[model samples]
Target: MSIYLTAILKSKKDKIQDLKSILDNMVLNTKKEEACEKYELQQSLDDEAVFIFHEIWKSKEGLDAHNQQPYIQEFVEKVPDLLEKPAEIYLAKLV
Candidate 1:
């Protein structure tokens, strides 16, 4: 089954640019990832605190591999300090 993830992030005011850069890198890397089907980021129109992310992978292994990627590893290290709270992630399977 395909792997799906929806993440909600709250950006800190001082880290807005850093978060944007991270998202940009993620977008580029995910497009190049072999098993990626879709990976996208969307900003909330009404709430400056909100960032919405969607990810799709060919399989659970693909998702796991994506998590282990270098940039993603770096992001994991950097993200906690850049956000108002920990990112809220939900895993899903297609109906």
Candidate 2:
């Protein structure tokens, strides 16, 4: 079955622009993966520092492979310093 993910990220007040740039690059790179069905990056209008990623994968295994990608790893490693808090991730299935 396909897997869906919603990830919420909050950038440090001063680092919002930088985080946005990084996320843009991530989206560009991740969309090239074979099993990526959908990937979107959205920024909150109410709170510019808050961003969300909505992703759909062919399967859980595809999502797992995405996590291991170098761009994803780089994002993980760089986010701590730029983010206000840890990312909030939700995994879901169709009803």
Candidate 3:
């Protein structure tokens, strides 16, 4: 079965631009993955510091491989300095 993921990240008051750059890079690389059906990024109009990712993966194994990519690992390392809090992630079904 396909997997859908929604991830919301909030940047520190001063780190929105930096966070956006990283996320943009992620989009570029993620789009190259064979198993990524969708990997769209969005910013909230009401809260500029909030970033969201709407992603769909072909399988759990594909998503796991994605998490291990070097760029993604770098994001994990750098996020502590850029984010206001841990990311909010959800796995949901289309129903």
Assess the local accuracy of residue 77 in candidate 3 as a C-alpha lDDT between 0 and 100: 97
Query: Which tens-of-lDDT digit does each residue in 11-87 have in candidate 3?
Result: 99899999999999999999999889999999999999999999999998899999999999999999999999999
The Cα error of candidate 3 at residue 8, in Å, is: 0.5
Estimate the TM-score of every prediction: 0.94, 0.97, 0.97
Q: How many residue pairs clash in each candidate?
A: 0, 0, 0
Q: How do the residues 33-73 of candidate 2 rate in per-residue lDDT, one tens digit apiece?
A: 99999999999999999999999999989999999999899
Best prediction by lDDT: 3
> In model 1, what are the clashing residue pairs, if there are any?
none
Question: What are the lDDT figures for the candidates, one per model?
Answer: 0.90, 0.96, 0.96
Q: CA lDDT of 85 in candidate 1? A: 93
lDDT of 1: 0.90
User: What's the distance in Å from true for residue 63, model 3?
Assistant: 0.2
